[model samples]
Target: MKLVRYRPAAGEAAMPGLIDGAGRLRDLSGHIPDLAGEALGRAAVERLAALDVESLPPVPGQARLAPPVAGTRNFIAVGLNYRDHARETGMAVPAEPVLFSKAAGALAGPYDDVVIPEGATQVDWELELAVVIGERVHRADEAEAARAVAGYCICNDVSERHWQMGGTGQWLKGKSAPTFGPLGPWLVTPDEVGDVSALAMSLTLNGEVMQQSSTAEMIFPPVFLISYISRFMTLEPGDVVTTGTPAGVGMAHGRYLRPGDAMRLDIEGLGHQRQVVR
Candidate 1:
């Protein structure tokens, strides 16, 4: 099932919904509070799957989408997890997962405008497969970590290279800008996503292809990353871990986003995202 959070209109409450077979949105608000915390767990998803989707009230007209999962407290990410991406930047493949955090406030709906922060010079993009944690776990084994996963979604790991590499060299400075983390058209449960390791993903800037690769290129897959992270910090429900981008970010080519530039990102089975720089 494809789960989503959205507002039917501006200033309205955000509600959870499911995308039925015919591509219509059906309200799931009566069934759950929101797609966060315990609602993200396997048991909750299983219960929701048993619902008769066709009977739910249909949401009319267009709605503004929020990130598929809400109340994300730890917006973590992996860096240099893709071999090709590592090679592109002339860096050696990491011996272990390189982790970082993007402030939860950076999260934005997939189609929301990506505001180029004032004085920003090297704004760039990183298309990544984002994993939403379903249950809290610490020091988990790979199998346990796998079970803790809620599902997957797309994440555009928007960056400001200057803030990331310059200044004091703190990655969070570059990565935590408002609207920097654009995620989800919807979240596809693991069963529906099939093999997570082989999905094709790509990003396009201004109608031109910029980044293209498969999840197969990842050095540390999702489950391992989750497990690795849990050893140090508790993985809470509704937290997101973006698995890192592939080769072809703007900085590598001396290109950067300017006002009005458009970006499109896609990960097979997880749907796509569109953003215009503003």
Candidate 2:
């Protein structure tokens, strides 16, 4: 089922629902408050699925979409997990995942505008598959890690090179700009996406295709990534794990985003995201 969080009008409170075939949204929160149940969002799906469709309320056409995962506790990212991206960035392929965190304030709707900071010139887009954890686990094994996953979504790992590599080594400086992280049109459950490594992904900037690669190219898969990270920090529900972007970022070509550039990205059945650099 396509799960989403949307506001029927501007300034209206966001609500969760399941996206129907006619493009109407079936309100899940009406019956399942807080989107919590036996398995969090999944339980809502099971209960909602048993209801009569004709009895459910229809959502407005003008509703504004919000990030699928609301109140993300920790938005963590893996760097250079894609071999080609590592090569383009002039970094060695890591034997283990290189992890970093983005401030939660950076989160925005998938279709939101990305405001390029003043005096910033090296803005780039990274289309990545983000994993949403379902349950809390510490030092989880690979098998347990697989079970801990809740869903998947599309993420644009927007970056500013000057702040990233020039001033300090902390990637958070370059990554934490407001509206830098655009996440999701939907948060797809794991059953919808079995075998995460076979998915295809791409990024188009202003109608130009700049990056195209497959999850098959990932140096470290999601299961191993979750397991590795859990050894160092406890994984909690709603904590996001952004897998890495493929090659062909603007920085690699010495090009950067300018006002009016639009970005479109997708990862197979997970969902798609579009953002304009303002």
Candidate 3:
């Protein structure tokens, strides 16, 4: 099931729904009140799928899309989980995942604009696959970790290099800019998404292909990440854990985003994201 959160009109409330085959939003407001709170689980989606599609009221015509996982508690990220990315950044491959947290305020719709912050010159794009956790788990085993996964979505891990690599050295300062985390076109449930580790991903800046690699190239896959990270922190439902990005970032080539630059990110099966640097 492909789920999304959208506001049908300017004043209307953001509602969750399934993206049907014809690409229309089938409203689930009548069925699920708080989507991210409870119905975001894999089981919930499967249950909704079992119901007659024609019964659910569809979101009327055009609605503005929001980040699929709304009111997300924890927006976490893994760094350099892709070997090529670590190589490009001149870092060693980690024996364990290098984890970081992004402010939930950074979350934005898939098509939202990414505003390059003031005094920020080295803004780069890291196209990544973000995992949405299904259940609250702490120090979970591999089997439990796999079962805890709700689904996946596309994420643009936008960074400001000057603050990240320069200054005080907290990557969080470089990340977490408003509108930096462009999340999804849809939150694809696990059953509908096959082989999470082998999915292809790419990022293009202004129609130019810059970053291109598959999850097959990931040094640490999703399952291990969920398990490893959980050992340190409790992952709650609706919290997002974004897996690392592949190589070919703008930082490797000294290419940074400026005003009016357009970036397009694509993750096979997960869908695509478009953002203009503002």
- The reply for model 1, stretches above 4 Å from the true place, is none
TM-scores for candidates 1 onward, in order? 0.99, 0.93, 0.96
Arrange candidates by TM-score, descending.
Answer: 1, 3, 2
* Model 2 regions more than 4 Å off: 35-54
Candidate 3 wrongly placed segments (more than 4 Å): none
lDDT of every predicted structure (CA atoms): 0.95, 0.83, 0.87
- Could you give candidate 1's per-residue lDDT for residues 124-226 as a string of tens digits? 9999999999999899999999999999999999999999999799999999999999999999999999899999999999889999899999999999999
Model 3 Cα shift for residue 91 (angstroms): 2.1
Question: What lDDT is obtained when candidate 2 is compared to the true structure?
Answer: 0.83
Give model 1's clash tally: 0
Query: How do the candidates rank by lDDT, highest first?
Result: 1, 3, 2
